[model samples]
Target: MSENRLTNILVPVFAVILGIIAGAIVMIVSGYDPIAGYSALLYGAFGDRYYIGETIRQVTPYILAGLAVAFAFRTGLFNIGVEGQLIVGWLAAVWVGVAFELPKVIHLPLAIIAAGAAGALWGFIPGFLKARFRVHEVIVTIMMNYIALYVSNAVIRSVLSDQGFKSEKIHPSASLRSEFLQSLTDYSTLHYGIIISLIAAVVMWFLLEKTTTGYELRAVGFNQHASHYAGMNVNRNIILAMVISGAFAGIAGAMEGLGTFENVSVKAGFTGVGFDGIAVALLGGNHAFGIILAAVLFGALKVGALEMPSAADVPTELVDIVIALIIFFVASSYLIRLVLTRFKKEGK
Candidate 1:
């Protein structure tokens, strides 16, 4: 493999390892057994059919969320507003699900499309500003996050909700839930969203790697002035890239609305799924397959953390610490690369 590819793979691996080691040290200092803690975590995430199902369920949205972030990153955009885009997408999907009475084939796809459209619209604003006026996307997207959060909550209360803080459950035609899958997994909330997420990963890969549009977007990301001089429409590519990125994020919301929850609920705070996507994309090196693997690891850790408290008497917060440490190491990857280069030189 090329040195860049090797570094990309090894960096995340080492980050995970170092994070786990640091967690063990913390556990030792707290008079807890690291082995027992990790064992419990593993069992919780994969030991039983139910846990396995839940892990997959958790992974579904994560894959799409990571894709959303990774897609924007590849196009040289930092889409911090994925949280907001996801919220609007969830609301849009739930709205479509409840309002429509079409056949299953039509209803399901329509609801999903509504989510993607909502997310795309949300994404377009910042893209427009960034492309047209050179406004920083980070600032625009961050503000939009709050707008999405409050606007969604208001819609739930005054528009979608009859008397409660949540919207009505979606119709069966629009639902992604499956009886056979549920029975197979001891009634865990696994759904067809996993299939959708996987398909999305493939779509991202094809769009970014196999198409002329992808080349233009990537070139714009590399250098806008150069790309423009090379005859690529830099502004259009930037806008298109953000729109596609937002669509991915919106589908992540559909995974929750149509698959897991079957409805949209008013939130006291942000969901954090969109925020976590940033880390997922970072750790995955902004590659489609890498993002899938990263999402799975994150899903496993999140699902497994629930077991730590009861199984090993370890605080669930320790898992959070480990995750934070992993991100820190990943962020400081230059140091890891420097060390690797030095070691290679000595060996030669």
Candidate 2:
């Protein structure tokens, strides 16, 4: 058991090391100082309280998005609709946020929950189709993504357009601000969403590892046929998994709008956070704690990359390249496993 655990940890670590080595080689070939560039990257990400706060801000949504993908993955589903769900969720949340006037406590949570419901409804269509008509989830999810983007743009134009491509700002009551912390941090964007995200991670971990529903989901994932034979409802589980996944993704959108942007803008384009969640989930090996760690890493990279071009003369695009390389190495972990096995055999 210890060896298995060690192998699992080392696999990801090795992947990261190899990715860094490959990135360094690329930097050298491009006539950049790899060491200095990396030093700047590290400093930019962790050098100050301001940067760290920004990193946490960026990580907030990533946690939800990562959980969305990881949860679906656990149930043998590939929910490519997270992008669409997030978009719709953002639109719904901000629409309600601006349209309502209520007490802070009631307004904020209600708008957020509305976002989750909207996202779940969007995901439910694909789930229904798959469960009833045997439709391929991959194709349905991809189509839903485009539909969501275009539909959202049209809604924004029709409903919120004041000759611009943006919606009205959310009501102050609906906003999730931490005035005390903001004052201390000089108005940094960090908000109460971080606490919500942490709670979500813990809840998801418990649901997946400790609950009977989790066992059913995993059993269905491992063998749907066997699950059905054992009196489990396969179709119901599939739909439930997708709905739950979409709900998490919706919360991601809510976090972005309520906590960060304070409103949804069609011109902001898709946050692509759903896609980024794929990388986070994969890099974290789909574990809840690992997902949090991975989200922070990616968040740090994003925040740090902004400072790179100005401080270290390295392009922000290089950071993307590094991330891609890391993802590639992670996806091909068998290569590292083989190498490790060879080394062990030789040593023996």
Candidate 3:
């Protein structure tokens, strides 16, 4: 393998191993058996058909959310507001699903489109500001997340809600739920969302790797001044990158509204999906297939964590600590590379 490819593949793997070891140490310190905890975690994630179904369902959204972050990263923009875009997208999808009465084909596509559009618009603001006024996107996106939270809550209470706690459940025609898939998996919440996520991954891969637009976006990411000198519209590509990224995040929300929950409820806090996407993208090396694998790993950990408490008498929080450590290792991969180089030299 090429050195870059080898490094890319090995880094995340090493990080995962180190993270697991650190987690075991923590478990030992906390008077828990690491072996039993991990065994329970494995069983919880894939031991039963039901657990497998749930893990796949959980993985669906993570894939899109990770893609959203990864796409923007490739285009040299830090899209921290994927959380906001996802919120608005969820609200838009549920609104369309509840309000419209149409055939299944029309209704489902319409709701999904509304969600992507909503997220794109949400993403456009920061993109525009950054492109036009040189405002840092990170600051704007962070603030916008709060704006989205409060605004969506208000809209749900005043506009969409009947009882003021959550919006009405979406129509059947607009839903992504699949009875056949559920039956196959012992009736878990698994739906067509996984298909959508897969399709999105393909789309991202084709667009970024095959198209001239993708090349231009990547060039801008590499060096905007050089891209502008090379006759590329740097500003436009930045905006487009964020728009596409937001669309991916929005679809992630639709997976919840149309596939998982089929309704929109007032969230007490951020769903944490967007934040997790940052880690997913980082671990995946910002590649399409890599993100899918990373999402599945994270989804497995999350679903598996539930069983830790019941089966191993270990707190579920240990999984979170492990995840944090994995991210830490991934982020500090330079140190890992340094150690690897020293070891290789010693061996020589």
Model 2 Cα lDDT, one tens digit per residue, 48-125: 776777788899999989998998898888998898998888888898899999999899999899999988988888
- Give the per-residue lDDT digits (tens) of candidate 3, residues 193-249: 999999999999999999999999889989999999999999999999999999999
Cα miss at 73, model 1 (Å)?
A: 0.7
Q: For each candidate, what TM-score against the reference?
A: 0.98, 0.96, 0.98
Q: What is the C-alpha RMSD of each candidate to the true structure, in Å?
A: 1.0, 1.5, 1.1
Worst 10 residues of 3 by lDDT: 1-10
Total clashes, candidate 1? 0
- Give the per-residue lDDT digits (tens) of candidate 1, residues 20-112: 999999999999999999999999999999999999999998999999998999889999989999999999999999988999999999999
Q: List the candidate numbers ranked by TM-score, top first.
A: 1, 3, 2
List the pairs of residues colliding in candidate 3: none
